[model samples]
Target: MPPPPQKEPPRSFTARWAALKNIPPFLVMVWRAAPHLTIATMVLRAIGAFVPVAILWIAKLILDEVVRLAALPDTPDGLAGWWHSGLADHLITLVALELGIGIASDIIGRLLRLVDSLLQERLVIDLSMRLMDHAAALDLEDFEDAGFQDKLERARRQAAGRMSLMGTIFEQLQDSLTIATLGAGLIVYNPWLILILLVGLIPAFLAEAHFNARSYNLDFRRTAERRETDYLRQTAASAETAKEIKIFDLHRFLSGRYLDLSRKFYAEARRIAQARAAWGALFSALGSLAYYAAYAWIVVQTLTGDLSIGDLTFLAGSFMRVKGIIERLLSSFGSTAAQALYLEDLFDFFREVPEIASRPDAIPVPRPIRQGFVFENVGFRYPNTEKWAVRGLSFTLHAGETLALVGENGAGKTTLVKLLARLYDPDEGRILLDGRDLRDYDLDDLRAAIGVIFQDFVRYAMTAADNIAVGRIEAREDRGRIEAAAHSALADQVIARLPAGYDQMVGKRFVQGVDLSGGEWQKLAIARAYMRDAQVLILDEPTAALDARSEFEVFQRFRELMAGRTAVLISHRFSSVRMADRILVLHLGRIEAQGTHVELLDQPGRYRELFELQAAGYR
Candidate 1:
């Protein structure tokens, strides 16, 4: 799937088969899905092979009768004898047989094609469904990497075209089989003629091989360009880009860019088309010359009476039927092999390296969680970063506690919260849950047991209640819980103010939806986070967008609303930080001081200095 500047795959016999072997499973998978249709196509082809022989046989009969009548003497009885004895009737019968064979061949061919189309459609549908299912199953982290995305894009692209390639391959197989059978019939009549036809095809076969190689090489080299073209199309056509495009009045701008890439694609295709046209013309002429040579030799033998007209006709018929079969078989062989490598790319994704691999199976219970979740000796650096974002950090909270993480920007507060929420597993040390390692629980279970209200929470372009309902997908429609959660977070007022209340949509991007103010959205996010009814909740600046009154009111009811829950608060607001039962002041990725707000205010530390600075501003 990685489209890049590249050379050709091996065009030799051995390499072609090797490539075919690489994707045997995919070929086998499709083959298995429609075995009856496959077998029927092959059988139809085998039957159609005899149609050419029937025509040849009939032609020879007609030729023999005409020759007999021409050889008659000039006497009255001799002239009329051949005509009277049903010689014309015999010729008419031959003509009728030829026409019948032609009609039967056409019918069978159409039927086979119809079956091929249906079979390919079914297989493609299954392939696309499986790919979508697998993509959804992959962990959230894999989507972050760039290399993975390239392969995924390629896989998706190929899936659409793969069905067509596969069907063509099967069709080619049928063509080859039919040609071979007809060739065998020709051998029984005149073996030398088959050799002459094969010799005539050698130049064409070689030329086609060269062209196919060049075509694939061109495709391999322009992968990145193709991706850029896809991006350009999306930018030009998508609704998301419509606003900017209309504001800038940039129709020509996008159209010109699209045309530029399209012309480049067209230029490459034109080059290949021209080469094929020239080669095809040359081969066609060669084939015509070869056929005339064979025809002349057959006529000469017929004149000398050394060969029957029947044998000559059969030779001519089979010669044309079999010439391109070898090329087709070779092309199909190549395609079947290349499909293997694509399937390999798809299967490789299933091999996962879990982000957290060393945890025990037994999860520790929070039975009471009186001395709430604790972070002890916890240190974490991002996967490829040199510096720790949060290092050797330690803090503790009790149930019903709202402890604020106070720090300057980039002082590791958000990183600490993410670590506690287990969005990431610490590179060193562990997160202790009620004096035990947090890694014991199943990853899904652990994540489901907590709620997070991010400052940058997504504003869904869906109905207001559905946005909150996404919190617990398995739960029944609990209108009561949904309403209560909204009321507590002060989002009920936002909904009530809307024309349609809870059923109203919340974004302009979707139908019948209106965008909300920053403060309204903040309250919605908070309500959504607490909607799941989890035991522990982490709010990373949940009220940052709210007005002074909303912020004060939420914090005032914070204790009553969050009772019996272990809640951790993150904020830059001095008033909110001062009210936490315990305040942990962080500096340079570690806790510099921890105490109640008044106790921290008494100390000459990072917290006290920040508090004094804020107090002076207020005065």
Candidate 2:
């Protein structure tokens, strides 16, 4: 069953306004993305802000000039006569000036839009890059945490979704300036007109703010559900899941589940939207009443000879423009606040600091090591879990030794390897490398020294050579090195079968890409370890997909190549286990037995029982 939707605390008006603090930092990010484009947008918008007032003033001059000419004695009777009399000169010039202003406004509007588009694109690119870099810096544990995953999902959406907020903010700036100029004219005529404008618009503005906060709260509460729906949608249609979905005939089940969640989301949104619409209509009617009331007063003053025809047109135009700008400014202010609330997600994700980072004065991992790793009474539990993954663990992996770990599922085999790589730090006790705490070594250097390929290694949808080069990406252009690594892992055999050889894209994710068999993919993954060629090498069930003969050959090559290197191998196959100089049997997150394979078998323990059971299958 789907879990109950999470509840979000009701957001107050003050809380929405408080989100405005995010705008400054957001603008800073925008500026940093493209400084010249940002500056151009601002300058153009500033100039455009005055165009409306200039056009309106020129329109008033044209009307007044016509009125004066019409009232003059001995006026010209035709257009040509008027030109000959020079009577239409000032009127014609006013019309041309207004036309020029209108054209310039249109050009400025287009330029602003072009600049805003470029700036927004740059911001999205910059934000996505920042998210990638920050996520890389985070600990593996952070990705595994559910709360962190939600934050990451929200931040990922915000990286692109918040681009609109940039344009909206600039529009608000331009509109605010327009309002100030338009409002000044209205105030000069009658301060009460400005008062009436505010009074009418306030109700609509308040209603918009209230509804926007509701929308944000609804969205915030539905984040996890939205993520689940997205996952379900992908699962039902993705190439990766297509085979299983078809085999199980899961289309109906998946589609039904998605529809159920979507309907619930739609229903909630519709409720708020309905309420907003109803209230908006009522409030908008009230504003219209206020505008007509002010218009009636202006008309009365004109009829009483208190204002000219030109004054009437100018007042009405200025009043209308001011009212519209103020309305939009208020409505936009609310929207900007709501968007700012979403910005919290992106910035919050950025604010997350990795707990497992190395110290500032961290030293490099020792080269040509005299000693190896020592896990002394190390204990660790995953975040938000009470159960320890590995507890009271003590082991020494000596330099140049090939140690094999034998265990069933959930026996902490993978967790132990992760600890060695410092993907996680021990909760209690410490790990030692060469007589010093493992935490003392520079984290990046420590990871570079150890190469690990796990059972669930990534199948990158990239060229075969690029796949191998990812292990040591700096050497990607070195074709000879990539081929040598592929040869060591027997991946060259798989590559030889591809149409494009090393250039072949070997995943089904992309167009014209070829898919490889499980064993073939394993060979490619093993090649990454060889490409790394680190001092410490680990193969954690990487050959599980290969046949016995192929696994044997791969291990044989691995043993040859791992000479003079510290190696850890985890496998279920007794044939491979017997080759290790020392073997550790793990059960329930602790060492159950430790000896050579023959030595363990002679002891008649769990190791022997498991080996004998496996051998029985052969008979």
Which is the leading candidate under TM-score?
2
Worst 10 residues of 1 by lDDT: 1-10
**Residue 377 in candidate 1 has what lDDT?**
84
Task: Note the Cα lDDT for every prediction shown.
Answer: 0.72, 0.90
lDDT tens digits by residue: candidate 2, 109-199: 8888888888988999999999999999999998986767888998999997999999999999999888888888888889999899889
Taking the candidates one at a time, how many backbone clashes does each contain?
4, 0
- Candidate 1 per-residue lDDT, tens place, 79-192, comes to 366457765677667778778888998898898788878778877887788778777656444565555565577677667766766665656656666666677776765687
Q: Which TM-score value belongs to model 2? A: 0.97
Worst 10 residues of 2 by lDDT: 1-10
Each model's TM-score? 0.73, 0.97
Model 1: number of clashes? 4
